[model samples]
Target: MLPLAPSFDTVGWLTRDLATLDRVVRVMLPEGSRAASGAAIPEVLLSVLDPAVVQAFRSAVALLVERGGFDKPDDVELPDVKATYAAFRTVQAAEAWRVHGPWLTEHPGSVSGAVADRFRVAAAVTPDEERRARNVLAEARGALRALLAERTLLLPSAASPAPQASAGGAEVDRVRGATLTLTCLAAVAGAPSLSAPLARVGGAPLGVALVSAPGSDRSLLELAGALVDETAVP
Candidate 1:
C-alpha cells in the first residue's frame, strides 16, 4: 500500500501449497509467459554469503541432482552482486526521497528515530549518484536478461540465517547488505524470481531461489511447483 520504493514493489499472495500458489499466480499474472530451458546455480554469489548459507545451497543442489534428476549446470560468471546492491540502494533512496521528502518536511517529528535517520540518508543522495546508479541498473538489467534468456539462474534467497530480533544495528546492517547483494539482481533486472523453501540450515528454512527472464512469471511458477512436487514424493 505505502510506497517506500514503488519500483521494486510487487503484488504478491501467500499460499500453503504449490497448487494453490499456481492458481493464485495464474489468476493474477497474464498468460503466455515462456518456459525456461534449464536451470543453473551460479557460483558468483557464494563469495558474498556466509559459509553456512553456501553449504546449505550446495547441499540443496546436490539433492536436486541426485533425487530430482536435475543436471548440474556449469559454473558461470555473473555481474558483481555487491556492486548491483550499491546501485540498487542508491536508486531506491533517491526515489524514496522523491516520494516522501515533502511529506516528512511538512510533518516533522511524526516518524521514529530509525525512520528519520533512513530518510535523512535518502535525502542526501546526490543527482550524480542517482544518474550513475541508473546507468549501472540498466547494464545489470541487460546482463541478467542475457544470462537468463533460456536458463533459470538459481541461488540462495539470503546471504545468511536470520539474525536475532535484538541484534545490534551494525550486525543487522551487515546481514542486510549481504542479502541485498543477492536480491538486488532480480529487482534491478525486473525479472521473475521464485524462492522454493526446499533447503534448511540448522533447522532454519533456507530458501533456494530461481530467477528467470522478464515476463516469465508463469513459467517460473510452474518450474517451482514441479521442483517442489518432485522433491516431496516418497
Candidate 2:
C-alpha cells in the first residue's frame, strides 16, 4: 500500500520462504519474467556501508551467479550518496507532514513521543527545500535509470543484522543513516527494489536487496523468485 507515497513504494515481501513468496506474488502481479534483466549485476555501495553487510551481500551475489545463472555483481558509482539520502529524507518527511500534521494537531496524544518530535521537524520543512530535493531526485533518477537500464544492483537491506528489541534508542539513531543509505537508492530513483531473505548473520535474517530500473517492479519480483528457486535458503 503506497497510499501516502506511491512512487517510492515498490512491492515488497517479508516471508519465511521466498519460494512460497513466488507463488503469492506472481498470482498478485500476474506478470512474466521475459523482460526481466539479463544484464551484468551491479551492486552500488555507499562509503558508510558496513563490512559485515558487504560480506553477506557478496555471498548472496555469488550464490546467484553459481546457481541462478546471473552475472557477477560489479561496483557502480553514485554521486553524493549521502546527499541523495538526505534529499529522499526531506521528500518522505515532507510527504509525511501532509499526511499527519492536521490529524496530529487535533489529536496530539495519538502519536508516541519520538514520532511526535519527528513531526516537528517535518512541520518545519520549507517548500524551497522540497523543491531542491525534487531536483536532486530528478538528476539522480536520470543517471540511475541509465545505469540500471540493463543491470540490477545488489545490497543489504540494513547496515547490520536484525536489531534486538532491547537495543537502545541512541544506538538506533547512531546507525540510522547507514541503514537507510542503500535502501534510499531505489526510493529516490523511483525504481523497483526487492529485498530477498537471502543472508543470515549473527543467527538473524539479513536481507539482500536488488535495485533495477523504474517501473520494473514485476521484473524485480521475477528476479526475486528466480533467486529463491536457485539459492538454498539454509
Q: For this target, which candidate reaches the highest lDDT against the unseen true structure?
A: 1
lDDT of 2 by residue, 124-216 (tens): 999999999989888988877777776777677778876677878777765676788777887777766777667877667787777777676
Residues 186-229 of candidate 1: C-alpha lDDT, one tens digit per residue: 88888888777777777788778888888989988876665665
Each model's TM-score?
A: 0.91, 0.85
Candidate 1: the clashing residue pairs are: none
Task: Show how many residue pairs clash in every candidate, following the order shown.
Answer: 0, 0
Overall lDDT per candidate, in order of appearance: 0.79, 0.71
Question: Which parts of model 1 are misplaced by more than 4 Å?
Answer: 67-69, 230-234
Error of 2 at 226 (Å): 3.4
Q: Any idea what lDDT model 1 has?
A: 0.79
Q: Which candidate is the best by TM-score?
A: 1
